[model samples]
Target: MQIKVDAEGDDAAAHDLYYWLRQDRELRRHAKADLTQAAEASDRMNAGEIINMFVSNGLAAASLLVNIVVAWRAARPSPQGTVTFDRDGTTVTVHDTSEETLRRVVDLLASAPPGGASGATDTGESSASSGSGNR
Candidate 1:
């Protein structure tokens, strides 16, 4: 997956925020665990056998359901624009689109709090990240 962040604020603050996100150990650990589990699950799926007609139909149905769910999520409407962060009474919204920025945002959000944001919150703007299975 990829992450994209855009911030409207001081260059130094944005860079520092990104750095802090990268150094967060919990985020890194969770991201590693998630990737590992996905890899393991992918490895365990064995698609070589079609035991009988019923089994084949069941597999096909399951695949269809999975595809449908993915499609539904893709079609769902989500908030658009940059994630806003409030630091020391200053509101900073992230909008960076660089590869490194994406990686950092992904890693940070992977293990962020349920709200997808942390730290200062006073601007009433959401500086949240998006992900699941985070601790």
Candidate 2:
């Protein structure tokens, strides 16, 4: 599965997440993740950019990603904001990084599609962009 993570819709936040995920042992083991740069300056490292990840183990990989993201969100000084995880057709935007909230994300990603594949949501009272679309 391919995952695109955007942090608070901010490029810097996305880059922050990219570097953070890079350092995660479990995440590194599960997926090959990288930061997406501008079309013009692809050589230089883009600090504030989206993160793209490819995983072979589907839900397990997504779960590891969310776990790392939740920890990263908590470690921030303040204003945790939100992070959106888009995989397949499911979009989960998280405001509160609680266990329950993160679980919802995992559930959505793991959900069975009409056929045999598709996916998962957040625990936040702010329900705006989280969608369980067909994968």
Candidate 3:
């Protein structure tokens, strides 16, 4: 005998009807086990998104903390001192940490054009143009 049934809404009622029709104990147990496994897999899938959100939020907080430290350092005034050193066998280096030097560097950058000192022209050529000819 063939029975035509449309099991759409009310899952509990549908499952009860299905159980009544399939009187075999082993079949019912197998069906229940499959449903349980599917439910667990679906739960894990939902939990993955929550875990990803937590990780992203933690990274964002760390990035914000780093930015705060950088801003604090930049706001502090530097000492007016100059240091000269030689390293790497034979290379000489001089570092000027004076306020005057910092001011000059800041002024130079402020006066520079948007793209840079070598501004771009309509023809896409650099203003501070230099080319190495075949020579």
Overall lDDT per candidate, in order of appearance: 0.29, 0.60, 0.24
Q: For candidate 1, lDDT tens digit of each residue in 55-118?
A: 1112333233223222332332442234332222333233433334334333333333334344
Question: Which 10 successive residues of model 3 have the least lDDT summed?
Answer: 48-57
* Clash count list over all predictions: 10, 3, 0
Worst 10 residues of 2 by lDDT: 126-135
Query: Per-residue alpha-carbon lDDT of model 2 for 1-135, expressed as tens digits?
Result: 333333433436666777888998887887888776545422222343556776654688768877887788777764666665565555666767655567877775555532454442332332333343211
> In the order shown, what is each candidate's alpha-carbon RMSD?
21.2, 8.0, 32.1
TM-scores, one per candidate: 0.22, 0.64, 0.17
RMSD of 2: 8.0
Ranking by TM-score: 2, 1, 3
What TM-score does prediction 1 earn? 0.22
Clashes of 2: 3
Top TM-score: which candidate number? 2
Off by over 4 Å in 2: 1-11, 37-48, 111-135
Question: Global CA lDDT of candidate 3, please?
Answer: 0.24
Which of the two, 1 or 3, has more lDDT? 1
In Å, residue 115's CA in model 2 sits off its true spot by 4.9
Least lDDT summed over 10 consecutive residues: which range in candidate 1? Answer: 47-56
Residue-wise C-alpha lDDT for candidate 3, range 1-135, written one tens digit per residue: 011111222223223333342444433332221111122323212221110001111333323322322233233344211111111111111123233433332232223232432322222211111132111
